[model samples]
Target: MQIEPMATATEPTRKIVQRDPARTRARILKAAIAEFSAKGYSGARTVQIATRAKSNIRMLYHYFGGKDALYVRVLEEVLLRLRAAELQLDFESMEPTDGILKMFDFIDTHFGARPELRRLLAFENMNQARHLNRSAVIRDAASPVLGHIANLLRRGEQAGVFRPGIDALHLYTAMVSLAYYSRAHAPTLSRIFGTDLLCHQWQADHHAQSHQMLLGFLSRPTTA
Candidate 1:
């Protein structure tokens, strides 16, 4: 004797909307990189980034908190990307010379191909590292790469292929300096030398020279 009520005529049907937070966050991050790189941290606007991302500013704030926080996230992201790429080097398992050569080639290839990375690094330096200092994530991200370099140097020294007394971090810095400087100063260097270092042949030449220089540096005997 129980009666069940059917749908009422005046009742409204409910519709559900699904939101993809990961995709939205990625879009925001991508847009933020372009805006931050082009304008530097201070000049980049959340609204502009949102517009570029085809998102709204509220979502940006909701996702990242604020401009400084977003910049920190961008730095964290860029550093993480660099760390990830660096981690792909199997230098630790290879012969020392081969490892060094591979490391150099990898650096050159990465920098030459990824201009956005260069721009983001340039922006970071432009701010005197204000935003980078805000992120512990970046520092942690750098640790493994640095450790890899140290291990490589130690192995090279042990195997008698590389000289002792060279600090791993220092050598790593040297390698980065040599690799990064080319792309970082390409415009001016190209203008000054009247040659496009960005071109394949030129970069190939530079890459060979870099490998030679690093090998020579590693080959020198340690003083007693």
Candidate 2:
């Protein structure tokens, strides 16, 4: 008995457990986003995503089903991040002109901060939005943004600050396109122009120019 007691170890055996399903799912989604953004859907690998998440391919499949499904979820996650942030802004309560500028600023800042989103959009466009089209979540989330812009335009019109017949879709598209192009094509544009568009000074100038262009458009009287 004394000899047996002398051989005993003090440490207890450790057991691995899936303690946090939500956290694991979020990590997988985040890893998927990074992988898809960098490699595009066609080039991205589930094994890479799993490794990035510090998880296994089996776990990734368990959480997201597979690569195509994971890519769609990544798209949904990135888009929803912007949509969720928009809901936090009280654009309706602000003066229309102020709201418009604020919205532009938010978008400019967001695009600057989330270059991955631009890459994702570019990749999706190349795919002709095959995955994006599959997502009703993305479709549903997009509507409210157009509605918000429409509301802002209506308020601005009532206040005589914005021109009539300014379509929300057109306005929204213009704003996003300008912001997207500047950063997305920064390397090429900068090389072509011989100036660094990615630099803070240039970006600031672009932001100001964009503000002026949009506000000027809104201020112009429409031709009958």
lDDT of 1: 0.84
lDDT (tens digit, per residue) of candidate 2 on 31-61: 8888889999989989988898888989888
| Per-residue lDDT of model 1, residues 135-166, tens digit only | 88888788888788778888888888888888
Error of 2 at 181 (Å): 0.4
TM-score: model 1 vs. ground truth: 0.88
**Pairs in steric clash, model 1:** none
Predicted structure with the largest TM-score when compared to the true one: 2
Model 2: which residue pairs collide?
none
Task: Please list the residue runs of candidate 2 whose C-alpha ends up more than 4 Å from where it truly belongs after superposition.
Answer: 1-12, 16-18, 220-224
In Å, residue 66's CA in model 2 sits off its true spot by 0.3
Cα-based lDDT for every prediction: 0.84, 0.89
